[model samples]
Target: MDSSSPDETAPAADQTDRLILEVARTELGLGANGGADGDLVVLDDATGALTRAALDALEGTQHRVVVQETSVQHALALAEEHRGALGEGRLLIAGLEDAPADLATLLAGRSVHLALARLPKALAALEVRASSLARAGVPALIAGGRVKHMTRSQNEVLAEVYDEVHATRGLGKSRALVARTARDDLRELPPRSSEVEIAVRGMRTAVTLSGIGSVFGGASADAGSLLLLDALDQAISAGEIEDTTRSDGADGESDGAPEEARAATPGEGSPAVLSARSVIDLGSGNGLLAAYLRSALPAARLLATDDDLDAVASTRATLESLAADAATSDGAVGTEESVGVDAGGRPGEARVLWEASLAGQAADSADLVLLNPPFHDGAAIDATLVQGLLDAVARVLRPGGQLWFVHNSHLRYRHELESRIGSVQQRARDRRFTVLQATRS
Candidate 1:
């Protein structure tokens, strides 16, 4: 268990004294590793002289569980399988290299008393998850293995989320910090909204947001904004939103007609008819496309899925309202006049609402998959997340099923899609975005 030897180069006496003083005074749960004893678990893959000594000191403890970090996907699978068995007695230790999504899923159902790591990515995820759990009244603890000069705003945010935050004395060339949380009755507060102006086609469009997180600043900025811009341009190019003067005689033809009668008769020179057994809106922001799909494919099943719980709830409300309005329409409609489709192709029923992550979907589930997949993790562009999404698409989409995804024109997803699933062809392209329609062979 002792990976470092005592005969190794010892630090100067002054430095050693400083280290001892720092560990004793500043570090939480420091000193001898005997206080928590069997109650604490240590997980570390990166070996070092001090960390190895710490692990060696806890050897005889019955509660100590050490799991070395490995491949993220494999580690996540193991964590899920062993989570129930460990209960709250175990602490899942992960390095900074672990996947954020995997870590989020693991921490969702479990009581992670403390997570110790030096990875910046892991630290950010831990902060976000801890904040979310705190807002939910669930006490969660996240400890950082390194600390440096941080801005006042950063420290304030951390203090707001964690019950206790402590910065360790700078050790050698590095520093460490610990954040702890205890159960409390923290009231849930509504998320603040902001308006971000994005430049699209030489024009700035404003986007409203309830929370500024990965969905807005990361993936949505790269995928959603570009996709919306492209879709708008395509609508213009296809004449779906064109402005044209109609004759007075044509206007008279539908002046007094019922809504159903108007829908039944296709307008002159309508866009090309698009048909499918079902349409799924992946990452359906505000469920706008879902609403349109519900109207266009009255007979076709429509399913909307998103990772955001709030979006799902909002969509449910929107769909229900749409159904009520459709039911009250002035047309001479029977029981078959419902707008949304059922889960299994039963007509005139509400669309099935389900929550799922792109990395954890079943196979051959949808006829059409529509997505504006996230392309970045925070400010850093990540192609792996996009690849994971495409992999999920490959699993969920039936053979010959199509994937209609919108992304910025700069991102090169065509190669990743082709490599993972099959061929990818650009269905539509514009100055701001590109729409890809891929099919599984």
Candidate 2:
């Protein structure tokens, strides 16, 4: 074992460390290394009390000495280098926190007699690693400074893999557990899943998963779960998913018309107003607006951003399908040879789809933005997301850019938008929805 002077800069010693020391000294009856030389190693010098107590217990035993330094890289290298030197003597590796994977694997391969590790979080990865070592017939001991109420199934996994599993009384609000994996009775256990029911706006919804998937009324389901679902249904029923097209002679431009003339000419059946550039569709469930933008703004640049990765992927699929349809239509119309980009310098036909966190998107970068920002994460209404949306608008829009968004009248987002982006005006309003427009100063 390697011994070094304790560093004074370690975190202030707490009652928990003192308790660990008293328990090891009294329960294990360890003394200084004056006689009975044995193999002993001190692992983490940062926690001097545990190291001292462990060293006191193994003093004067007929064991060779090996020391593991605290640096993760160094400790791993040392373990690999001295694996052959361990012979038949027991190895004790103790620390306030568990070692990293490479070091743990190297130490386990050595003729390790005992392995002691402590960690802050009881990670699932650690549990899996411990199970593998226990299966290899290695005697491993894992202890923590605090106790945590692990799932009953996880506890069973530990009990099945280790010879002994012990948990101590709560230390303040934290708890700790110790597991010894030295016996042959260890058995692997089967994994299980559970279901949870959430009540959102008086509607019962069921979700199935291993852990509680109903927290905050299925916020994990994305956005304001039930509200977003209802909004999406409304958007679909409102014919928001229809594909709009413009006619060949709609614009008075002949085959070789100038770019400005093509811009001024209205496609035969297309909407008079071209879709705005630099668009953002928040709460864009399934990306209907993004798909609409692709066709509506065939000449204008388009950006369809959402917070849901699934929605983004779905929108991408829809846009790709639209592109294929456009390609087929081009042959019939005698339009340009290609479908996406034209010789007239029109914007690319493909839509740019992206995922963004409303609370975290960049500002002052868009010419036009659309939003159906959520009012809550779950059952509880969070006005903070409204502020986040306003902030995102301020960050992602250029000066004088327009922001068109839909929301319930009850939200009263006018004041919030006015405060962040300068003026807010209600362009349209109804019982179930209000369409508001704001412009950057």
Q: Which candidate leads in lDDT?
A: 1
Q: Per-residue alpha-carbon lDDT of model 1 for 1-441, expressed as tens digits?
A: 122233243322233233433453344353354533332222222322223333334444444333423233333433444453234433343421232222234344433223333323333333454465465333323333433334334445567666776655556644444455743645433333444444433345454333312223321233453455455445434533211112113222324643223212346666322224445777654444455445444444566765543344344444554565566442111121111223353332335332344443346655566787666776798867776667777887766566777877887788877776677777777776788877666
Q: Residues 1-441, candidate 2, lDDT per residue (tens digit)?
A: 232333354344455565444433333323433422233333333354444444435544455433433233333333333343333333333221232222334344344444333432334434544554576555544344544434444455567678677665655654444566556765542222333343422344343322111111211233332333344334323432212122123442335643233323445675222223344555444444544444444534455544432233344444554565566443121111111221122333343322244333345545556676766654688868777667777777666665667777677788778777767766666566677767666
List ranges where model 1 is wrong by over 4 Å.
1-26, 30-84, 87-142, 145-150, 161-165, 172-174, 179-186, 192-362, 374-388, 411-427, 439-441
Lowest lDDT block of 10, candidate 1: 331-340
Estimate the lDDT of model 1.
0.45
* Alpha-carbon TM-score of each model against the true structure: 0.50, 0.37
Per-candidate local distance difference test: 0.45, 0.44
Flag regions of model 2 displaced more than 4 Å: 1-275, 324-346, 352-354, 357-365
Q: lDDT at 6 for candidate 1?
A: 36
